[model samples]
Target: MFFTDSRLHFFRPLVGKYREVVVECVRLLYQKLYTDLTGYGQSHGRDFVIDVFVEAIARAPLLDEEVGAPEGRFKDARALAGFILNNLLDNGWMERRLDEATLQSHYGFTRMGRGFAQPFVESGKLEYRSRNRNTRNTRNSLQAFAEKGEVYDLLDALEYSERIISDFADTIAELEERRLQLVREVESRQLIEQAADQFFDFIDTVFKPDLEVRLSADSVEKYRDQIASLIRQVRRRRKYGEGEHAELLWQTVMEMRLRKLLPGRVVEGQSLLENIVHTIEERLQSACDIMLPALRRALNSFTARADIIIRQLSYLHRQADEPLLDACSRLREMSPDNQEQALQRMGQVLAGVRSGWPASEQFVLRSRNRRRTVRATLANAPGLDRDAQKAQFISQVLDQAFHVSSQHIRAYVSDKLITQGRVYSKHLAVQDARQLLALAHVVSLAGERLDNGFEILIHPARSDSAGLQVFEASNCGDGYFDSRENFELELVDRQRAS
Candidate 1:
């Protein structure tokens, strides 16, 4: 349908011999009519448009090959400007309308003309506007729909979701372009200073303001959960709507379709609202799971390329600064025979010369002593019988099982203290050799802090006579031990102790 528009024939000027001049003129015209803010006038007259066109023609450099002989009426800049203007007016790129208030004919760009001319104006300019806000805006719009139940908010959210992925794709493309440009510069031998300037210019203009924010706070992944929840809420809320709201939304969607605002065919059984919701969800998922990683990779590649360029530039700079390096490089480039001859000459020149300070110690000539070699012999150990091996393993197992570690001590004390709230050394159940050994360790550990939220307190025995205060520990055929129970164990919590 767009290609069928008669005004698209205006593109003929762009492809003809005067394409450069036409592009320049269009850019200038767009800037004056829309982008330029210096003037307060709402519209431009025919004379003003012709003057702007004349300025563009003068600024443009048309080559001899492109500037063939023209008609007599379009020989000069003003005449050419007039001819171009007439062509634009005939093709609907611009229109001349009389204003009732001013009673004067004012020249203005048509809607299609303004839309087409935007790219001409924006071409070759670095976009500094932050693109990272789309994801956040999408989240906010969804949240508004969830809270306020507005169908327009959902529409706005769908638009923002589409923009988010496009923005990331554009960002990655821009980085790739910049990286390639740097590579070209490096290949062209635009060394250290120029490369450094370009690298930092990219960083200051694009990276810090946009890409950094995109990867961090405004990341799609960061808001994915909230957006998903809000989408679910909006969908759930819309399902319950019966009469007015649903009809209003359907009518609005149809209106948008008529206006060509909503692109693509709607599914047979699906409403536009459902289609929009599904699209938003899919776009968000693709952005988080696919586009975000691609963006990260692009950024890393750009950085790595920049690093390599700087390193190469630095190396070249060093080679330029250092004469010795230059000489070495020349020598390397020389033939083998020539290089050998040059080395021999240098060696002859430096044969008797010393470059550093003399050594503090006098040089002494000493006889060299040869080291005696010793051959390693294999060790022949006697193998033990099965009975001996079994006995040895049993002993090791017993030793490890009854080992008096802090864990064993804590477990034994905790088990005793759980019911009684306190444990005494004399009253400790010495059921076997392990218990007998635990009792000895428990007495030794008295008055110390155990990290199991408890402490051990020792109380002196009442009687000094060993016979009455002696506590004996015996096991059934395992082992036995006896000790004077000179102290009592009390379990105090570390909190109370503190």
Candidate 2:
């Protein structure tokens, strides 16, 4: 707690005056509490500050193993804490407050304490964590807005979608601009080599990490789905003219016009919702400008330069080649005959560039004008006439259902039955209520009615002790057993004459 009384004074020092102490204090706190739980001094060893130092060093063995324990540094843990606390407290980096309920002094970080500790934390020696944006939730919200065909919902979806596309373009543009800055900063080849470390660090630590998250396949797929769904929903509602809030928006706009405040008024005869859709579509379509061939060429050139430098570094670490080996052999045998051989070997080593192997040239060509084959043409084609088709199809279905011999002569029914209702001398048997209904459709289509005395039967299928029922029976020979299905249907009704 701070007081405005004249006796109360807040002493804040420049970070440079006590930066090292601040860093040490924070490191000790993390090492003792979080990283190195064993670093705390025991009650008996509290006065032995050397043991505390030893414990602290032991906890962070990898980074602080070289730090030796200091002897005769402090009286006890209480005294040591007081000394460190006073320095931190004096600098306004920490605060000590008396709790009203507990009546005990509580030590906690002040604004300065958190501000000073950030650098140590960001050093990445203590901990590391990566957080990605919750793009899925954001996209889902936008999709919901699009699906709900209200004026405000459509407006919200439009704004959200536009932001996503614009943000993508902005990030890529920023990276392109940063890459250009290297030219002004780098003067010579040595400078370029020096800048390479910083450049690659920025790419790896900042640029690439961010871009990877933003362009993750899952996020991209969800984003595309959301955008496509929004587009479809918007167009669908517009076509149907069935949004709930359109009337409300129209009234609001009219009110604005009455007041001479022409908000969202367009010259074209389009509602505010329709204009918003058009604007969103145009922005999204143009968002791909960053990925166009022209910009891609520039990006490729930058990558090519970086690759050349990387390859050059690899070449420096490479082993001696055959030409160098030959040169060494000639030099070792210093004879007159070896002089010409040494010259030839030296020439081979100096002629660094070589033609690529001829066998490596392989590629497949795809014509730009190649047409896509229509594989679904069969589904789209018109089929045989509906009337004759329905009769033939129903007859075949009945044959499969009954499994009866053709000697009954019911199988000889013609397609003419589908076109004209006729009084037949014979009856058609249907196995179940479902089949009876199916057969009724065809009979109804023929505009024929059943005779006054018609028989229709339905019964449960035969079931064993296991409760397993046989729903179908097949005819093996001239004789087929009586069907024992859920329902046996004898077609009793037909279409009446029109």
Candidate 3:
């Protein structure tokens, strides 16, 4: 009783600073003196502070070795409380060395026994939490007290504290922006350029073609100049500072390279670049002063829009030769007239621009002619080549996924229903239909409902079939298809259909 009385008397003086803090601490200490005893110090938000003494006891060996002390002896809540309680009652704890950090952190058992003591939250005390923006909970409450002629210390504190904190936040944000600029100059640009160069190199390695080399020296230089210039401009923007909107646009260009739109293969590289550059040139030329509605959103500003278009072109450049070559293969599927029309349309987009500038008056004449070349190339040739290309694409992803080859195994999947560890149908040497179905099944079982990236699954053979059962699946969650993420073999199916 004397101990409780002394503690309460000690708390009374603290009310001068705050009544709530005094009430909360006293309530908690009282609970520790009574029920819900645990050895863990101040744990579950209940128990006496005496638990801290369990450490020294745990270290001393017992005289009688028969006591089978459990592992992590001080870890027990009951032992913790027992040790602390014993120390407070048997030892002179009041004279022990102490510090502020220890005192501020110590907890006595309060009503809530969940590792946190419940300090009394008074009726008009300041609540520092973000349940909702405390817009109405502000010194707005002080308006009533203002009319009552009450002391305004709380209101003044809240008002000044808010301004000081908010200003500090803004100042920190400005510093962060400066830091990003410095990072761009010294670090971020190098990473972006390295990424871009990697993408282009990959394209050159896999898809380099004889036809691109066959182009006249003048043609080669012209295309080279355009590509090099674009790359340089992008690197500069990343290295130096550009407007946020412009930098973001440049970032999109970088993303295309990362995405393999500016692929790492040589065979498809050149033709893809030409196709993209020519298409954009044709669209923009056609629009003239008329806002070229189609290309306007794409090429509006030089920094952001143009950089994005260039990045996309770079992607196509990386994959050019294969698509064009495959385009030739699918020409047989088209009518003789349509085939001729496609080549002629392509010739035009590739025409007019001898050097840096495109040709005069007739260049973009109208909407039909503006996008005509792109439309013709894609509608006729790509439709056909896409068939075989889809197959090759599948081969690439599968090679990357399973670390295997589709070179000799054209018809890869069997029509087997996959068991738990299932093999699939696309593995057959048959046509693209089997490949397409097989690829779809392979991309599906990746348990992709949560993650938003491509997943590769290998389904084991169904039932008792002997052939190798390998299927590739990519889960397209939320019912969205990724055009670029497509496997090359599916392009074969598309060509056959068109």
TM per prediction: 0.60, 0.33, 0.17
Native-to-model Cα distance after best TM-score fit, residue 315 in candidate 1, in Å? 0.5
> Which TM-score value belongs to model 2?
0.33
Give candidate 1 regions above 4 Å deviation: 63-75, 98-104, 124-127, 237-268, 328-498
- Give all candidates' CA lDDT scores: 0.76, 0.49, 0.37
Tens digit of per-residue lDDT, candidate 1, span 1-498 = 664555767666665556678788888988887775325655588888898999999988774444454423456898989888887887768888998987999887888888988988777455666678999999999888667656678788989999998998898898899888888877766454687788988898888888889889899889999988877765552232445445455335433542364446555555676677779999999998899999989989999988887788778877789976776888999999999998898789769987887686877779999999887998889999999999999999988986887667667767767777775565666576666677667766666775677777766656655443554445222335544454566778888667
For model 2, the stretches where C-alpha displacement exceeds 4 angstroms are 1-14, 17-21, 27-87, 111-133, 144-213, 216-306, 317-498
Candidate scoring better on lDDT of 1 and 2: 1
Candidate 3 Cα errors over 4 Å, as ranges: 1-139, 152-186, 189-353, 356-498
Choose 2 or 3, whichever is better by TM-score.
Answer: 2
| TM-score (C-alpha) between model 3 and the true structure | 0.17
lDDT by residue (210-236, candidate 3, tens digit) is: 112212321222343343344233334
- Which ten residues in a row are the worst by lDDT in model 3? 484-493
| CA shift of 314, model 3, Å | 10
Instruction: Estimate candidate 3's RMSD in Å.
Output: 37.5
Clashing pairs in 2: 431-488, 431-489, 448-494, 448-495
Candidate 2 local lDDT, 1-498, one digit each (tens): 453332133333223333344355555554443354434443212233334434443443222212332222455445544555565566566666786885766555566566656566556362323423434433455466555434554555556656656556655675577566665545455555555676687667754666557556324443655666656654552332335545444434433332343363655455554565567656545544443333445556666656655665455445235556665665878887878776787788779867876674476666799798877755566778999899999999987775533222223333323333332311334555543444333322222223553222233334566453433345311123243323222333323311
* Candidate 2, run of 10 with poorest lDDT: 61-70
